[model samples]
Target: MFTIRKATVADCDLINRLAQQSFPATYRDILSPEQIDYMMDWMYAPANIRKQMEAEGHVYLLAYNPGEQPVGYVSVQPEGANTFHLQKIYVLPSCQGQHCGRFLFEQAVSYIKSVHPAPCLMELNVNRHNKALHFYEHMGMRKLREGDFPIGNGYYMNDYIMGLDI
Candidate 1:
């Protein structure tokens, strides 16, 4: 139902807006409001997103329906020569039931394949308490490891690192 396009620096603010819409809702049940706000500002602020595109090697893919109505987004960052990290993937709340998540996920894999045609590793860290953990598992990712990583202000991301070979 949506077309995927590579996001540019100009779309950083839009990406931040989308994150503001999805990130808190995704973590609401598992995280405190303070932590949510902290992460939102830390990871999704427009300046941070701009830096992710400009300085880091992250490549964002935005999903839009007809007339450029945004539906979802996913980002892949190359790590080393044979591995890619899925840094972010989300479907807007309004589009949750429409299977956009799977679409975006497959698109991410496809994007990775396009860039590294040879077999490579794709990894993502999912919150241990997040329901999406099962989604990642069902999509054929296996838990590579788990860890509690400190972010700042006494907050930690208790996450399961999952991986798939592509």
Candidate 2:
């Protein structure tokens, strides 16, 4: 079984470590090694994680097994009236077949529904070639459009923006 807990700034190191392991594991096949390294430092740096939790209005939830080892995590931020942006969602590669992603995604939606009760929707950007595309579709999200977001240092995120009605 797994348990979900709200993550605070104190969890920055844990989140960063998890991202370091999970991000490359997930994207290694789809993205270049340089790109993956760039994105990891850009998004999952401990300082960046801290800023996200403490100042960016992002809510992060962590999923752990009985041994207290983090298995997955998700982050969401309110983007404006009636819309929340799903900034990040990752499950350890070793834990992929265990429904950890589903549990985290469902928990994220549930938490958002409870706190912001409205006919809201959640949006997320998934890599165009990410295998998780089907997973998100299975969870009732539809692709809205495609985007090539320039992150920095000549890196661009080729993504499909997907949305889920709440």
Candidate 3:
């Protein structure tokens, strides 16, 4: 079982900590260790998370296990009137098979539908080599496109842009 809650800026540190634990493990094999470290600071820094929440309009949700430990997080951002981007979703390695990822993905859809009840597109860019691509496909998302987008520090994300109309 899991509990999902909306996050405030004060929870940035918690989110960062969760990312520190899960993000590296999620990308350890697919990315270079240097890139993982760069992305951890780039995406999971408390200041960056706060900026995303306050300035960028990204709504974040945190998941907790039955014992009240934070195990995962998801964030969704409105890309356009009819498009929403699943910016991030990660579950702790220890919690992977327990449906926490599915719950977080569903909650993200629920949040999107709550805000834009009309038919809209939900998109997520997952690493082309990441195992979660299969999970996204299992969740009914189809590959819409793929790109190698540059981030910074000579790093690029080669990802599949998957989508589902909800």
Candidate 4:
């Protein structure tokens, strides 16, 4: 069984730890160790996660298995009057084949529908080479454009911007 819950401020530590394990594992073959380490520290530092929740209005949903272990998590940030940015989504490496990602995504969509209740757009950026593009496409998101986003420290994320109408 699986359960999804809205993350609280106290969940920062858990989110940090989950990102530490999931982020690197997911990108192990695609990113260099240095880049992966840099990105993890940039994005998932406990302080950053806390800031994202408290100050930036990012909503996080955590997925837990029946054993009560967190299996995946996703963060969404409202970007405008009608657009929500899917900032981060990661499923534990061991849990990838179980459709945890799709479940988490559906939960996100359901939350938006409940809270926003208007014609909305959901947007996300995916690394150009990530195979998860197929999953997003299957979920009804389309690639709108591509951009090289600079994340400071001389690193850039080359990504495809994808969008889904909600």
Candidate 5:
């Protein structure tokens, strides 16, 4: 069985390592190497992740296998009164097709609903060309908007903002 729990500071290094391992496989074909490098440095650095963990508005969750090793993670933050942004959801490639992603997503949805109890909506952006877009759609997320998100240094993410109301 897999277990999910709140992440602690000690998990930062492991989280960063996971991001490094997963990000390239997911983005190397979708984004330029420079953009991927910039994003990794800007978003997954230990300091940035630790700060997010310390922030009241953000929540980071980890998924552990039966043996208690983390194999997946999700990061989320409040976007508005009743909406939350899924900043990232990553599962190690070795563990990818085993339903871990779905499990983590369900936990996130449940947590947000319990905390907000309002008309809670979960939102995330996916690259238009990403093969995983179908997975999100299959998981019941609808495309709410589409636009270009500027990431900096002349790089932009051409994405579709998908949402699921819980």
Candidate 6:
């Protein structure tokens, strides 16, 4: 069985590896190689991830299998009062199609709701063309905005900001 739990410093390297392996597959067609590299470096570097984990307003969770190998992760940061932004959600490609992504999402939502209460909103930005957008919508997230955000190095992400009120 798969289990979801809070990430720790020891899990950073595994999370970085998972990010490196899973990111290219997910963003290769939607983003340039340069952009992918930049985002991965900016977002998934072990130091950066550790900083987020140690930050006051961020929560990072890891998913593990029966053998306790890390297979997926989700990161959330406070956007404002009563609002949280999903910084990233990634599942190892080998683990896809098994409802692991949905399971992580539901677990993240449950965590946020329990911790934040007050009818907080959970938000995430998805590449407009990513099939995950449909999954998010199907999971009851509504598109709140759509726009292009430059991801540096002359690359931009055409994305939809999706939100779910808990």
* Lowest lDDT block of 10, candidate 3: 20-29
Residue-by-residue lDDT tens digits, candidate 4, 32-84: 89999999988899898999999998999999988999999999999989999
Cα-based lDDT for every prediction: 0.93, 0.93, 0.97, 0.93, 0.87, 0.87
- Candidate 5 has which clashing residue pairs, if any? none
Per-residue error for 146 in candidate 6, Å, reads: 0.9
* Each candidate structure's count of clashing pairs: 0, 0, 0, 0, 0, 0
Show model 3 residue runs off by greater than 4 Å: none
User: Weakest 10 consecutive residues, lDDT, candidate 1?
Assistant: 63-72
Better of 2 and 5 by lDDT: 2
| TM-score (C-alpha, index-matched) for candidate 4 | 0.98
Find the candidate with the highest lDDT and give its number. Answer: 3
Clashing pairs in 3: none
Instruction: Report the lDDT tens digits of candidate 3 across residue range 1-166.
Output: 8999999999999999999999999999999999999999999999999999999999999999999999999999999889999999999999999999999999999999999999999999999999999999999999999999999999999999999999
Each prediction's RMSD over C-alphas, in Å, is 0.9, 0.8, 0.6, 0.8, 1.3, 1.4
lDDT of 6: 0.87
Weakest 10 consecutive residues, lDDT, candidate 6? 49-58
Best by TM-score: 3
User: How close to the true structure is residue 50 of candidate 2, measured as C-alpha lDDT?
Assistant: 90
Model 6 lDDT tens row, 94-145? 8899888998899889889888878999999999999899899989999999
Candidate 2 RMSD to the correct structure: 0.8
